[model samples]
Every structure is written in C-alpha cells, then in structure tokens.
Target: MSVRAHIIHAVTTSVSVKLMRGQLAYLRSKGVDLTVLSSPGEELVAVATQEGVSYKEIAMQREISPIRDLISLCRLIVFFAQKKPLLTNVGTPKAGFLCGIAAWMTRVPNRIYTLRGLRLETSTGLKRAILLLTEKIACAVAHKVICVSPSLQARAVSEGLVPLQKTIVLAGGSSNGVDTSRFATANIEKHTDLLQRHNIPPDAQVIGFVGRLTKDKGIVELVEAYQALKNEFPHVYLLLVGNYENGDPIPDEVKTVIKRDTGIILSGFVRDVVPYYTIMDVFVIPSYREGFCNVAIEAAAAGKPVITTNATGAVDTVLDGVTGYIVPVKSSEETRKAIRTLLCNPELGKEMGQAGRRRALNEFASPVIWDALYQLYGELINRR
Candidate 1:
C-alpha cells in the first residue's frame, strides 16, 4: 500500500516516545509514514530505531531559557520546513508550544498538540505565568488541541487555552490505553520465576507503586502509609518500580523516610512492568497529581486492586469501590486505611481485580483507542 500520509510527533523526552511505540506501530501498519523527533537520548533514539520510525533529535530544554529556547525554535522550524508532515503531533507543554509556534511559522498543514497535563500546576510566580502563556500558545497555534483526560479538556476550555469546539479527547481518554491482554493476570503463573529472582515470597501480599519517586507523586505519603501498615500486614511487600529523571526526582526527605522501611524493594526502571504487576496484590499511587497513572490500569488488568489519590486523571480509573479505592491526595491516614482494607480482605481485592479486568477489556482495548485516534486524524486532515 502507498504510504497515505506523513505524520510527525514531537516530545521532550524518551519516556513519552517509548510509551507510544505500540501506538506508532499500529499507525505504521495502517500505511502512515511516522517520524518521531525529540531531544537526543538513549530512551528516544532506541525505540525509534527499533520500531524503524524516522527520528530527529531537537535541542529542547524544560527549564525557561530565552537564548537556548530560541536556538531550539530555529531547529524545530528547520525540521518542520524540511519534513512538511501532513500532521504534526506535539507532546509535552514545552515541546508542544515550540512545535505549534514552529508549525505556524513553517505553515505545516495540520498542527496537533496533545495536552497531557499542565506543568504550571506545580509551579509558582513568574515560572508559572510563563508556563501558562506557553500552554495558551500551544493551543492557539495548533489546528487541534487534544486532552488526554476529560478533566484536562474541561480545564483547557475554562482557561480559554483552546476554543471549546477545537478541543477533543482521544479514546474514552488516556494517552493510550493499557494492553489488557498482555498485562492480564493469566500470566501470573509464568511470573513465578520473576518472584524467585526478586526473592519475594510467592504468597507475599505484594503492594506496589510504579512511577517516578518524586514529591509530586506523594512518595512521602506512600512511605508513611507503608510504615504504618507494614507492621499489621507483615507479609505485605512494597515494590517501587521507577527511576527519577529530569523534571521528576525523588526528594531527599522521601528517600530518608523510605530508608526506614526495609520490606520495600526498589527496582529501578524495569523494561517489562508486566511481571511486577503479575506479582502485585495491591497497587498504590497517592500522587498529588497525575496526567493519568498507566500503572493503575496495568495492575487492574493483572487482577490486582489499586489504591490511588483522588486526583483527576487517576480517580477516574478506580471506580471508587468497584475496581479499587480512591483516597484523598497526600493523606497518609486515608491511604493507610485503604491499604488495610485491601490487605484484610483478600477476597474483596480479588473481586475488585476481576471487575477491573472486565472493565478494561470492555472499554479500553488498543484497537478501540486507535480507531478513535485515526478517525480524529482523518477529520483534521479532511477539514478545511
């Protein structure tokens, strides 16, 4: 089949690029010529190369810097001019804003900005003001503004980031849906070797958190909750699976607190998070905020109950009590209560996990997501 269109996705880091590989592969199979461009790194380059997608490394920085940002803008404009992609999809507020501005400058036909989350939520003063302007411009210059969550879409509309008519949410709403088939608990038996390798007892009540161990993620509350519950549930093991990088880093205070808990295991950045999910009984993510916790879905798919904060993106995943419990943001007592409830009632946890798996399969298979995305792309490409 003739390659129907050329599409470009711009992201600031490899993490987004890596996470979207499956999505990209799906698009490629449908006859789209896909090119991914972003900052130079092992994370971005390796995936792009492995997937046989074209990639260009643009010099983009997260921090505010007028001079460096100017050079980065020039580089992006150059890339836009040369590639002239049919649709340019920009991710991350910084790169998205730059891509929008550069696409406008280069007059690319379709400029798309994926509004994952607002970085300004955690900032203050001049920095926050700058981020606000950046998000506004990203929405303004794009032909389409897409929010990954309904809450984000509503916020963007209320803030006038994008005209309400121009914004849309892909899928039922997630950057991409979790692969329930691969992440399912049926593979739990196969992961016994992983359990032995990690030295976790096969029968251990595995309590886990998977993401950057940062203050914003409420890692402090997680440490405190673990400390409070570990004594009561001695068989419970806390597994942390992520490596802090760039904008997200673990606070020293959080580190000091976790050091006091010996049952907690830190496995920095595993390639296959599925095995970890296979071994977990309960998943916890008390994030102060979240674009969306993909791990929560993965855990639910693996027939494991989840306990997460009532933050926008995350709260939607856990159906209160049906799938898992949603605790207050940054509240150790609430998180502890949720954990204790799950640990105390293994049958309830199993039932919730089963409910979660059914929900994911019914609502969020990858094909369902890709169809929505492709329809949106077709609409944008065909629109005047």
Candidate 2:
C-alpha cells in the first residue's frame, strides 16, 4: 500500500485549508508524502502540526494585484523547482493560477487544479472577463482539474473553462466529505449548555445558516425570507453561525435588519459548527454559487432537512422534495415559502432530515471520498 509519491497542495489563504480538514491526513496515511502551501497564518501552522505534514508559506493574495501577483509567481516557480514534487495540486483562484503555471514551468509530471468555484459566475463586464481568462489559464497549465461537484464540473465544461477530458468529480460531490459521526444528532442534554450560552429558547424552532454572511451567500435574501416568516411564526428563530466578510459585503440595510431583529442570533465564526447544527431544526444555505456547499451536507449528516439553491454546487447537496427543498437563487419569496412549509409541517421536515442523513451516510462519507481521491492520484502518479 506504499505510495512513493511527493505531492504538494496549495491554496490562496490559510483559512481555505479548512476545506481539506482531514483529507491531507488521509492521503498521508495511504503513504503519500504531502506538503501544504498557503499564505502565512496561525491556522496554517496549526494545520501542519495537527496533520503531521510539512508546509510552506507564500503570501498569496485573494484579489487581483499585478505587482504582488508577479512576485508570488516568481516565488512559486522557485519553490516548485526546489521541491520537485511528483504532483502539484493547487486550489483557490489565485493559488490555482500561479501554481499551475509554476508546476507547468518546472515540468511537474502531474499538475492538478482543484476547481472550487467560478467567481466569474457572479461577476460582470470587465471583472468577469478577467476572472474567465485567469480560470482558463489555470486550467490550461494543469494536467487535471478536480471539480468538487458534478454541477461545477459541468459548468466548467459548459463555460469552456476546461475540457471534459481534463476534469473530474470524485465519489459523489464534495471537496472533503462530511464527518458523519461528528455531525450526527447528539444527546439533547449535551446541547443544553450551548443553547443557553446562545440564549436560544429550548422550545423555539431554529432555522440555521452557516458560512460567510456575504452578498454572494444570498444573506440579503435569507434575511428577507426570515423577516417575512417572523410575524406568522413567532417561535421560529434564525441562527447564523458565521461572520460577515469585507469582500462582497451584504447590503447595509440587510445587515441592519440582521442586527436589529430580535429573533435572529448571530454566532460569529465558530470553530466547532457541529454543536450548532444539533441545535437547528432545519438548515438553509441560500448561496448564489459554490464549488460544493460543505455545510449543507454537514447539516444533512446532523439529520436536519436542508433548504439550498440550484446554484452549481449547492444544487447537488439535496434531493429536491426528498432530503430538502430546492429554491431558486436570490428569491426571498420562494425561500420564505420553503421555510414556512418546513416550519408548519414538522413531520415532513423530520422525514426529509432522516432521508438526508441516510444519503450522507451512503454517498458522502469521508472515507469513501478519500479512497476515491487516493485511487485517482495513484493512477496519475503511475502514469508519470
């Protein structure tokens, strides 16, 4: 079972490394020599220690900066030349583009660009054109492109970002599959302390959302939907588990509502989201786009019915009407209707939750995805 290959994975920022939580360790256990490269931060240091892997820090920027980007590219080329890794797998828009070129320049036998999401999907005019060009360049230099979800893969091909032959979706559709055991339903008593700390009433039905509270995440629509239902459903509480981001900021008016609304409890940036999921009766992710909505699957693993949009990765997370309802992106009315339906018919929500849990266990388990990825890597390395 020895995999005598050296592989380096890169992302733009340290926080983005959370997307691959247990994945690098899994690859290491299968005997692949692994190294993580990202911008310098405590999270990166922590990941290196926790996963028992070597790491390199490169100050990569998320935004377009011509001067800094050129400097970063030069550094990447030097790093690749020094490491000479058998495979270079890079993700995040910035890292993917730079590392793809660096890996190609250094003649890395297996180059991979992990297509997380297409920012151009939401951009327009000049910005959209720039994003599209960068995506194509990243894909052009990489030997393989790993789209996290089936829909994302299809979108990449449809948009001509990458050819069908160069892209793949491992197992079902997730970057790192859900840790079902950690996210499953917990003892009611075990959640009491967390509920009390958050000041959530025990009898209140919670509608939860996780991930950044940004414009693209459809936070404005989520707020609108919750406000619409608030009067009719007095006991229903909206709990947002993540913090706001400066980039793609939500409308000021929407932010004001989220803060002023008595029913909405904002729990900014939690390390352990599993506990929060246990407190939720139903989960909602109204994102406009995603590579794959990990939180939606995590909610499913927690045995909660999910309401997400038909946007790329989000669309694949739930089985419409079965595991959860699928609403159109940015439709507050539809989002509100879906929320009301679940809140009114508790039994239907329970049924959907159970079905979602079954789907999570059967299709999106971590080991299943890790094994699939390992096999793919093995095939690629052997070809080299």
Candidate 3:
C-alpha cells in the first residue's frame, strides 16, 4: 500500500512539531510518504530538513480570528483535495479545529485529531463554552482521537467531547517519549562550560523548571515557593528554561522577583535543553494544566528527581514517591516542602533520580514510542 500522511499544526517552532520529530522521520523510514504543514518560518525549513519530509506552509493563527481562519480552512481543503493523502493528523487548538474540518470535508481516508489538552479546563463562562464546542467539532470530524495522556482522555469523555472508544493514549502517555540516550546523566560533564557561562556554581544545588513562563504553569506559585526555599537552602538555585508568553501573563510581582533574584537564572527559549537538564539536581513543574509534562520525563531521563503538581497529565508523568513527588495544585507551601525534602536528603534524591531514569528507559524511550506509533498508523490505514 502507498501510504501518505500529513501532520498539521499552528506554528512550526512549537512543541507539537518538536514532539513528532523522531516519529515523523521513523515513519518516513518505514516507507510512509510524509508531509508537514504549519505557518511558514525558518523553523519550518529546519524541521523539514531534519525530519527528511516534505513541508507545506499554511498561514494559520493561534488565536480565533474568523477571517484568517476561513482563509486557512479554504487553503487546507484545496490542499487536501489535491494531495488526497491517506491520513491527515491535526494537532494544537486552532490547526486541529480548522484542519479537522477541512480533512473531513475533503473526505480524507483517515482523519486523526491529536487532543493535546483541554483548554476549557482553565477557561470560564462563554470562553469555556466556545472552547468546548470547538473541541467537540474537532473530535467529531476525526476518525481517531489520540489523547496524550489517559487522564486527558477521561476528562474528554466526562466532558462529553468524545466517546471513550474513539480515543486512545498512544504507548504509555507522552506526545513524544524522552530521548533517553540524549538526556542521559553522562552529558553532565560535557556541560561544565555551560555552567560557567551561566555563573552557576559547580557545587550549587539546582531546582529547574522548563516550559512557558505563563500563569497557568503555576509560575507565580513556583516563584513564591522558590523564595521560601531560598531562605532555608541558600545554595539552591532556581533555573528557569523557557520564555514568557503574552497570552497568559505571569504576575508583575513574580516578574519583579525573577529580575531581582541573583540566584534565579532564566534561559529564554532554548533550542537544546538537555544540557540544562544535566545541571539540575531536581526538576519541578508546578503546572495547573498539561497534556503531559514532556520536560518532566526529559528530566527523569536525565536522572534528576522530579516534583510536579497533581494536575491531570502531570500526575500521569511522574510516579509519586518513586520517580518523584506530586503535590497538590496551586499550593506553594506544598511545593516548597517537596523541594525541601529533595534538597535535604541528597541520597534520597539520587535514588529517586536513578529510579526515574530506569522508568524512562523502560517505558518512555523514543524508539519504543516511534515503533508503536508507526504500527498504529499501519493499523489505521489498513482498517481504512
């Protein structure tokens, strides 16, 4: 069978494409003709070259702009009709909604909607209703709906967005499994220069957080917790490895603390985060919502103990008291306590980190996940 697939997303530089990088290349190697579509940028060219796949640029906005969205839908419909791909997988909110509709209208053989997360979980009033409607529409148009985590699947089913039978969590629960070899503990020595550049003392204990510096990520609480922890452990440094998003702005007080604190290091929008993970002794993601905390697994693969909130997807990522600790959502005191526990007991932290690495190697390896996804695609196409 001649199988052709198209993966669509709103932005080229975003996590959706990053997560699919290895999987896309692996699929291509297995004789699947692959094409990627996103808004045009230098990253689009880079991704196409890296993945060894054809790429088409479609200008799609992340926001709900009716005129632009209509243009994008028309373009996608024409593209799908002409290409007639065997499968089209749409991800991210805007692209999923628009491309799902387009693929459905063009009668694509296998329409896949990757429900990364429920934006409605954090929204309210009319906004929540609108998000719910769009989610329903996206799922309704697709033949298969892949949730990144089981909790997200349950949430969708409970919310009446999609039936349980229509959705599946691929492999265990990660959009992209962690690259264990790349994120392994061996890279720590190699990143000594990076530590020097950042003025991070070699003996300093590091608590790291990676992802957008937005309100929903619990950045405000994290900052407050870090301040409390700093009073106890002066040697502990907070390493934040992401840029701030304008959509969900963090409080001014948090921004002020970030700017004033000498112990806090912010590496804005890094391309390669493996080295950053290497320097961290403990990784923390106090997110209020997530499809799955990819960085948490990446940190685990790097042999660092994790401390994340008991949020839907996040809770699934870390096995509490085994690989890491899970505190209640929005609790700064609880977050501080978790951090202190890890920091105080160095041996315990090391043990947990080792356990996390083992778990990552066994369950969340990239090759394992890629193979599963490839097989699923074959199954999906053959069924069609």
Best by TM-score: 2
For residue 186, give model 3's deviation from the true position in Å: 2.6
Clashes of 2: 0
Query: lDDT of all predictions, in order shown?
Result: 0.81, 0.90, 0.85
Error of 1 at 142 (Å): 1.1
Model 3 spans with C-alpha error above 4 angstroms: 1-15
Q: How would you order the candidates by TM-score, starting with the best?
A: 2, 3, 1
Error of 1 at 86 (Å): 2.0
RMSD of each: 2.2, 1.5, 1.9
Residue pairs in collision within model 1 = none
What TM-score do all the candidates reach, one by one?
0.93, 0.97, 0.95
Give the higher-lDDT candidate: 1 or 3.
Answer: 3
lDDT of 1 by residue, 24-45 (tens): 7788777889999888888788
Q: Which wins on TM-score, candidate 2 or candidate 3?
A: 2
Compare the candidates by lDDT and give the number of the best one.
2
Per-residue CA lDDT of model 2 for 318-374, tens digit only, reads 999999999999999999999999999999998999999899989999989989888
The residue-level lDDT of candidate 3 at 246 comes to 90
lDDT of model 1 at position 348: 98
Which residue pairs in candidate 3 collide?
Answer: none
